[model samples]
Target: MDNPYKVLGVNENASQDEIKRAYRELVKKYHPDKYVNNPLKNLAEEKMREINEAYDYLTKNSQNSTYSNSGSSYANNNSSADYYSIRNDLNRGDVSSAERKLNSINSQDAEWFFLMGNVYARKGWYDNALNYIQKACNMNPGNREYMAALQNLQMMNNSYRRPYNMRGYSDRDSSFCDLCVSLWCADTLCNCMGGGC
Candidate 1:
């Protein structure tokens, strides 16, 4: 709705890395769980939604070239635009369409794996999601987005206990807020194990 850059708290000419950093910070700050018992839960959800929209818009419209999983620079080609479209599909809860689009693509680049992981995640296939995301992270080790996705899936997998329902066992699932917090906590834990965050 508003200017995407302003919504993400980034300058109009900000680098992609800078925009990404701001997006992650905003996601952490406005995560829905933080306001679960607070009066601003609805506001937090709205803010998070706005943040996602802004980030998606920026990524889709960016004209700059970026390093691919193979450490080679790639231009924003048709496939790249298709990835953005797939992201929109996922955002709109159209996992099947996203998956179909992914299957149609031949290039299994870092972004491809990352989006495939997202598709699996949406399908409640956490294990597959984790594997695909981990592959993406390994391919583009320097990409914080891939790393964050990997860590989020890891934390989701580790923390899920699949609580028993009154009648029987139900599937365990994580919300976007849960996944975001899990990513932060997992990153913190990993860093602490080595030294510190």
Candidate 2:
């Protein structure tokens, strides 16, 4: 759609890292969470779709060009293309279709697990999402994307506290108070002995 570099607000000669940074910034700006319950939600969604398309197009073209120029046969190219399609489906809120497409693929690479985790996460299956994302992280420890996904999933799982639920202060605060009382007593004793509080 148009020039991907222009869509991402980057020059055609920009490095991959620069392109990725621009893509991420656009994604953050147009993310659905930012528009929740707002009148601009539809517009935000459209922007997000365009951003995703631009990122995908640039990434796929870059990979193809690099591989072709190097005379290298990328065996995972097809699966990678399918993964991008699945990602687009997921971005469009088509979880069932994405899952079906994922299941049709035989390979279980890091990207596969990552996409599966995304599907589960979208469905509110946090435990399953964590498991799959952790697997993806394990498979590709150096992958920033997978690591970020895992961290995000963990944060989501940990941050979901019921509004009516209250924490008990008995165990932790009691020990802390006891320690403080003992310290104060020791300080008073030292002051009496001319040590100064």
Candidate 3:
């Protein structure tokens, strides 16, 4: 609503590529998925909406210097609005409501898959979540939000154990080694006491 460049944190003279990069970063930062279960989810949603609007305005009026005079609105479709509502529901931990709304949608777009992934993730179904999020990333390769979600899921899946080489010893193995050392020490002590040293 104000300066588009300011909204995106870019200068007026910034190149188109720079503007796009900034927009992508902001989108990633304030994505609904990142704000899930956070108290600041509403604020993040508002920020994301503003970022989307600014990006749309800049791209549409790139040729014209008088960007402020352009009265063009963001190209928000009904499905997109619905997706935003679903994201709000998901953020509030209402997976069932979000799932119901998502399933009612006629078009299974990238956003749909992304939202479905969020629902699955909340339900502790990581495998299904990863599958759905991967599909979303595949469908919208350039979408930073979808790509980030997929990366996060993959990282979570691999976070439990250290690599084979890095794993020096497990707790069970260490305990066994400790027991062996104690028994050997006791044997040596007993021999010394019996004058066998």
Candidate 4:
């Protein structure tokens, strides 16, 4: 393994708080849930494992005092981790599992609605998807992720309508090309957040 300080992206002379902060950021970035269903999932898991080991080593070896991850002290704590796991299930094409997990969560924050919208979208329930995503956007007006998801849903809705309007065909007859373009745009949006799609 690399030097513990280097692994956590901190220098040897850094204070404990600096090390903790860097570790937290890296944990969020490389969490296994973030990479699940991506081609890089295994790499992300390995990186996370490395980070945990480094964090443990550094905290344990601190000369003045030893700190340990006692569950509550970690950055990607349980509640956030639960959300990440739901995202992992969704990306893995396990909408049912994701939905079940989401439903079990009591809080209905912007993230919850956004994820529910994604599940509805996956299940081809466009009306429900739009409603939930719109609610998410309303709850957190400044969130780009919610906005992008809503736009992607709207684009898909428009794509389905354009074919029926122009060719007098059913929405099911929408061109595959339009669908692909919409998906490509959505994936680009997700990529801007560091990972997804």
Span of ten consecutive residues with least summed lDDT in model 4: 68-77
lDDT by residue (1-197, candidate 4, tens digit) is 43667778877667889999999999999998987789999999999987887777566545422233321111222334466567768867999999998899876766678889999999999989999999988876766777899999998888776744466655555667679889999889989887564
TM-score of 4: 0.51
Per-residue CA lDDT of model 1 for 60-157, tens digit only, reads 54543363344421232456557767877898898999999999988777778889999999999999999999887776686777788888889888
* lDDT for each residue of candidate 3 in 161-185, tens digit (9 for 90 to 100): 4575336677888788889999999
Candidate order (lDDT) = 2, 1, 3, 4
Model 4, residue 96: distance off in Å is 1.0
Give stretches of model 3 more than 4 Å off.
1-76, 160-197
* Whole-structure CA lDDT of model 3: 0.76
Deviation of model 2 at 82, angstroms: 0.3
Compared with the true structure, all predictions reach lDDT values of 0.77, 0.77, 0.76, 0.75
